[model samples]
Target: MIENVAALAHGFAVALTAKHILFMVAGVCFGLVVGVLPGLGAPNGVGLLLPLTFTMEPVSAIILLTSMYWGALIGGSTTSILFNIPGEPSSVATTFDGYPMAKSGEATKALTFAFLSSGFGALFGVVVVTLLAGWVTRFALLFSPVEYFAVFVLAFASFIAFGGGSPLKSVVSIALGLALASVGMDTISGSMRLTYDVPDLIRGISFLVVVIGLFGLGELFETMQNPAAAKPVATRLDLAGVVRAALEWPRYGVALLRSAVIGCWMGIAPGGPTAASFMSYGIGKRFSRNGPRFGKGEPEGLVCAETADQSAGSSAMLPMLALGLPSSATAAVLLGGLMIWGITPGPTLFSERPDFVWGLIASMYLSNIVAVVLALATVPLFARMLQVPFTITGPIIALVCVIGAWTVAGAPFDLWLLLLFGAVGWLMKALDYPIAPLVLAMVLGDRTEDAFRQSMLLSGGKLSVFFASPLPATITGLALLCLVVPLAGMALKPRTARSAAP
Candidate 1:
């Protein structure tokens, strides 16, 4: 504990320097713009700015990108709270309750809660990162290919059960992600597995291209097509509401803690903030007096969902930083960003480059506070952006998506892939296939495949050897349960429905 404290102290000294703080502020400022604009997410924004960092010192570059990451994560809640749009993927659930509060004329208060609670949740998560990343890193390093593959199986199971609509369709999307993973040349052998004719296929589809198409590009198309779907203009808030939210802050302390706790658990588990936010909102509704009229405009629901989503987002950084396992699409891009900068994130990162680790850890604290203060100060300005017409907004979204995609590789091929995935994403949304599972599958597929093959080779092609290891046995068992629970639930559905019938 003392050593960790000492490290944090040193980190603060390094991070609080004027030069570093200015860079951190710049990153936060950039991230807020990225987060406010539809179709310009954290990953794309960071990826676009990564090259510019190459000329700077490694630590500064990391601080900038990582702060941008936290800023974007924090800024996403603003849109979710004020407009029904989620500026980023993780904030999607915040819209369930946040927008209602805005319509009810609690826009300033809702924005306040979102920003402050996000700061609280981020602190909770960063504390965990400081105290627990070492242990988590050790554990992560112990996993082999078979273990990772099993974990991947567990990851996909959630979509099957909760993806909504046809389970088969979700499964198909997962399969498609796996297929896309196979497009790259075989790493072990020189021979290509599925790259038909194109040389770009040799490296396979870029995850960023895929994500941009599915999210930014795809959403742009959807917005343009929905000509009749006009966005509601939000009214400006007086300064009084901000003060009111602060005065009521003490009352919601318990709820904030509750949401943060739930968010951490959800982040660490296979389920994500989408689940966490709804779960927290449900609890608030059941317990709070205003629960009955939650959708009609209630602060409790807004507080619950916003806090949970931000908390979950903050905690999601842990798996990626310590274990080299990205818990979300944004984290995956972050992982890629770290690699681009030649900073390999994992156990060795702490030991080999304490400056980078502590600097980043320190930046989290600085950025979290900056995000809250900046968001609160700028909420009024951001809230006005909702007034942009669909024609204008839709084209800007397309432009950002195209530019982000093109910047990924500076290749026309990536633009083509973006167009392709945009179409696929539209189809997936239309067909009710969950995009989350597809992203999870894409990010983990390569690692899982590598693990599976390595495990087979290690076992001398005797697959039974996989069951021999305790970790493998445990992971496989859990994965089996993940798969079985959905089927079992489906099987029991009819009997329960019949029994409940009058």
Candidate 2:
């Protein structure tokens, strides 16, 4: 324990360097800007900035990226509270109570609770990363190809099972993502599956292009359609309200902790912050003493949503760093960044690069503190941002999205892909289909297929190999149950509806 503390202290030494601190602040400001703008979540935000870090040292680069991630998570709530716009997808739930608080002229109360909860969630998640990532890596080392494949299956299964809205839509979304992922040449067979005759298709579609298009351009189109989205609500930052909310923290402490746990678990799993925020909101609504008050400017709902958003955003890094698995689309982008920097994340990564791992962990702690302070201090500025006309802001955002996409490989094809995916995102929103599942599948499909194929090769194509080991069997069973439970619920829905009819 003492040794671990010493290592963390040493990591702080590395992270506290003048250069690193500057990068952290820069990343946070960039993230805040991205987050305050609708449709630019962490994945698109990080993707946009990743190219600029190519010239920096790997450690400094990651510090900047991760700090940007932290800033984006906190900044998302700002727009949600003040404008009823979810700056990030995960901030959707925050708008439930946050916007209402603003409507009722209690914007300061909502902002204070939201920011404080986000700070708590970030701290909780980083502490887990600092103390638990090594142990998590140690445990992940025991996983074989079969077990790893099962874990991947479990992730997808959990999303399909517990993800709200239509299960059929979720399944279709996953299929679409998988189909997109299959466009590139097969790594093992060295053959093409989905690509047309275009030479650019050989490289497969860039995930960054797709993400920026879907999140950035798609959002721009929606905002363009709705001019009312740019209208600002009146807000006041009452210090007295902030102090009262702080004193009332104990009242919402249990809910906060529960939301944090849900966020952490979802982050380590595949559901990510969107799922975490929604799930935490549901759970909070279920158990809060103020349940009836929810969605009508309820502070508890704000606590649940904002806390889960930050917690899950932070905790999503655990699986990425410890096991080389991305728990969310943003994490997938960061994972790609790590590989770009020649740092392969896995069990061996910690032993091979203690400085990088610990420095990142230490930076997370400091970054959260920095984000909270900055976010609180800048609330008035962000409120003014709500008044920016879409005509001016929309064009700037569109240009940024285009540039971000084109920068990936300097390929015109990527720009086209961005437009295509942006249209797809718009259609999905129009159809009320969930985009999260699609994003996850697109990011994870290749790795999941690779893991499954590797397991099959080890077993000489035996199907039973997936369940041959205890860990694999257990996880596979859970995956199967996830699928079955959802199906069963759907099957019973008609009968239940008939029975309840008048």
Candidate 3:
């Protein structure tokens, strides 16, 4: 703990530079624009800016990206409260009470609660990350190829079991990603396997290009198709109202703590912020003294949702940094960025690049504080941005997507691939297919395959290698349980319904 504190103190020195602070402010400002817009979410926003970071130091680039994420998360709540629209998926639950509160003339209080709770949740998550970083890194160092493969399996299975989507669809998405990852060449065999003589195919598909299309263009298309017609609720933050809300914050202490716990657990378990917010809201409704008044402009309900959402958003970084397992789509994009910068994610990352890791951890604290202050000060500005027509923003967003895709490798071929994947993304969204699993698989597929192959080599092709050691055995068993429990529940649900039929 002492060492981690010292490292964090040093990290403050690294992150407190003028250049880094400027990037944080710029990132947060840009993120507000992205979040206030309906289609361009944090994942898409981060993907759009990734090409710009190619020339930046890894630490600075990450600080910028993560700062943008915090800004986007806080900004998402603004739209939910003022416009009855969720700017981000995780903010959907906030609208349940947030919009109602605004409608009841408590817009300032609602926005204040959202921003402050979000700040608190983010702080809690960062504290958890600081405390667990060393332990998780040490634990991960003990993993061999067998254990690594099992861990990857566990990640995928956890998503299937708890992702709140069709397990079959998740499996299909993972399979597709793995296939995409296998396109260029077989690393061990030194021969092209999936390329059918096309020059572009020889380089394999770029996940960055895929992300740009899947999130950026895909969301633009979706938003254009179903334009939001809600007008912003006219309101301004008053100092008196803000002070009143801050004073009343302690009244919902139970909800905040409960939601934070749920958010952290869900984040580390592969259930992302969207799930965390909804779960927290549901539990808060059931357990709170004001349960019956949850959806009708309850401040505690808004607090519950916003707290969990930000907490999960922040805590999801831990798994991504320590284990190279991204629990959310945004984290998947960030993981891809790490690989692009030649910095491998996982246990070795802590030892090999302590400065980078600790700097990022330190920035989380500073960035969240900045995000809250900016979010609170600029709520009216972001709310006004909603008055802009989608017709204008849609074309601009589409253009940005095109430029982002082209910049990936400066290839026109990626532009066409972007359109193709944009259509795929739109189709998947229409079908309610989970995108996180697909993104995670695409980012980690090659590593997972290499780990499995190395394990096989070590075990002389014995399938039992995964269960030979206690660590691998435990991980593998958990993966199996994740898969089986979900399947078992699905199988039993219909029978239970039939037996209960009158």
Point to the candidate with the largest lDDT: 3
lDDT of each: 0.75, 0.84, 0.88
Off by over 4 Å in 2: 1-3, 235-244, 247-251, 491-502
Q: Kindly provide the TM-score of model 3 when superposed on the true structure, using C-alpha atoms.
A: 0.96
Better candidate number, 1 or 2, judged by TM-score: 2
lDDT, model 2: 0.84
- The 10 consecutive residues of candidate 1 with the worst lDDT sum are 493-502
Model 2 / residue 244 / CA error / Å: 4.8
List, residue by residue over 1-502, the lDDT tens digit for candidate 2: 5656777898899899999999888888888888898767788899888877777788999999999998998999998988888888889999999999888888877888888899999898887777786688889899887888898788778778877666677789888888888897998899987788889999987677878887778777876787674555754577787788678776888988999999998888877888899999999899889888989999999999989888988988888887777877788888878877888778888788989988998899898888988888888887787688778888888888999988888998898889998898888876767776777777778878989999999999998997887889999999999888877787878466335423
Kindly report which residue pairs in candidate 3 clash with one another.
Answer: none
Assess every candidate by TM-score.
0.89, 0.93, 0.96
lDDT (Cα, tens digit) per residue for candidate 1, span 120-216: 8878877877787667777878876677666667667765765444556667888988888778777778678787788878777777788888876
Model 3: runs farther than 4 Å from truth? 492-502
Between candidates 2 and 3, the one scoring higher on lDDT is: 3
Clash list (residue pairs), candidate 2: none
Provide the lowest-lDDT 10-residue window in model 2. 493-502
